[model samples]
Target chain A: MSEEQDIKKIMHVMRRAPHGSIYTYEGLEMILIMAAYEQDLSVAFIGDGIYALKKDQDTAGIGIKGFSKTFMALDGYDVEKLYVDRQSLEERGLTEDDLVVDVEVMDASEIGRLMNEQDVVIHH
Target chain B: MNIGILLKEGPYNHQAADTAFKFAEAAIAKGHKVDAIFLYNDGVINATRLGDPPQDDRNIAARWTELSLKHGVEVLACIAASKRRGINDEVMIEGGEITGLGTLTDIAIRNDRLLTFGD
Candidate 1:
């Protein structure tokens, strides 16, 4: 197959809160490995998943290693397509400014449309 | 179409494994090729042969083993995830293998669709 055909559109959908569970953390690890393959990749933050990008998160009290800072490093891996649901942010009274990484805050419908275009959509 | 399934939850405690098995079975019945079932997260628990639920309940691990044997579908558990959960080759069900994420990446690339079943 040609290089163009080799490139697949893969989206990692995050819909869970961080620290409460290991889904989001393991999902991030999967993204890091897949990023090296140079596929067209994107990550969507929905529901409580938006909290994963919240700035100034302190996991020290919970005794879990803080990985919120790792979101800032995604850009270096060329996995820059970070998306956040606007309604989810508003529901939690957060704004793009409150996020640890720069992301395109979009309506859920817009994200849904993008999700339909992906060959793979994994939720964590 | 060739399909790959990513199952991220364990059996009994959650319905992901059962649902994935049903989906894979239906897909195969329709003549679709199920390339593999890649187990990650708590999904590695699905590959253990040590699970012996009540006789009335479904044997999730054995179901996967049967699916692989009958349909040539590969059952792969992530090595890192399996190790963390104390799952090894000795305890793995028949037809299940411990593999790396690189295999998952390849499955995602080569398959026409990659479906994830999780929380």
Candidate 2:
């Protein structure tokens, strides 16, 4: 480790629901790319993007796969680091209890720090 | 480091700018500097001087203006996005400068990291 290896931390900030659009899904795909093809990939859910973390999303009514299920396999991609903003959760009335996965519940300040530490960040 | 904060949607309709600001403020807090915030696609709406939000919503428009005044975060509204959406800055009056792509590239290279946040 004489020379610094490019850790290349990528943070995918998703704040939308599971369907009606491809933004959130596309973001997850990008993170998959980072985790599968690259190195040091992380994700942060912000604003409505945090909604993607709901414990059990019933997307079938909306004609989409319950996205909460895919989140179940995050460990397979080695995308272990997930963060949710405290303010975003409070404003939206969401708490870790409501979420399906364990995420680093941080404030805006912590999320910003995560972004600064990374080599590349993509927000979808 | 090169920090690219992609704004993917309008202020009121999405949280693109709010998330970007949070990231920027946090980056600065940890002693890291944000070189530039690239406004692309719908993200370019943050640059409109004629910013207006509904009475019931928060003022994200004002937040962008404050980033410059308070944090000195260089706001580089994408020339392509700006032109498509109609955003023009002082230095971008002539030629392709109005798009602000050059500023984005400059900031990317100058900063320590480049980040994008699409709403």
Candidate topping TM-score: 1
Where is model 1 more than 4 Å wrong at Cα? none
DockQ (Cα-based) for each candidate? 0.78, 0.13
Q: Candidate 2: misplaced stretches above 4 Å?
A: A1-4, B1-119
Report the lDDT tens digits of candidate 2 across residue range A27-114.
Answer: 5644554465445668888878888888767766767666666776788888889988999999988789998888889989989998
In Å, residue B114's CA in model 1 sits off its true spot by: 1.2
Q: For candidate 1, write residues B7-38 as lDDT tens digits.
A: 99999999999999999999999999999999
Error of 2 at A99 (Å): 1.1
lDDT tens digits, residue span B1-119, model 2: 44555566656566667888788888878877765566665666776767556788766656666666677766666565566566777423111124344454344334565766653
Candidate 2 chain A weakest lDDT stretch, 10 residues: A1-10
Per-residue lDDT of candidate 1, residues A1-124 (tens digit): 3579778999998988988889999899889888888889999999999999999998889998989998899999999999999999999999999999999999999999999899888888
In candidate 2 the C-alpha lDDT for residue A101 amounts to: 86
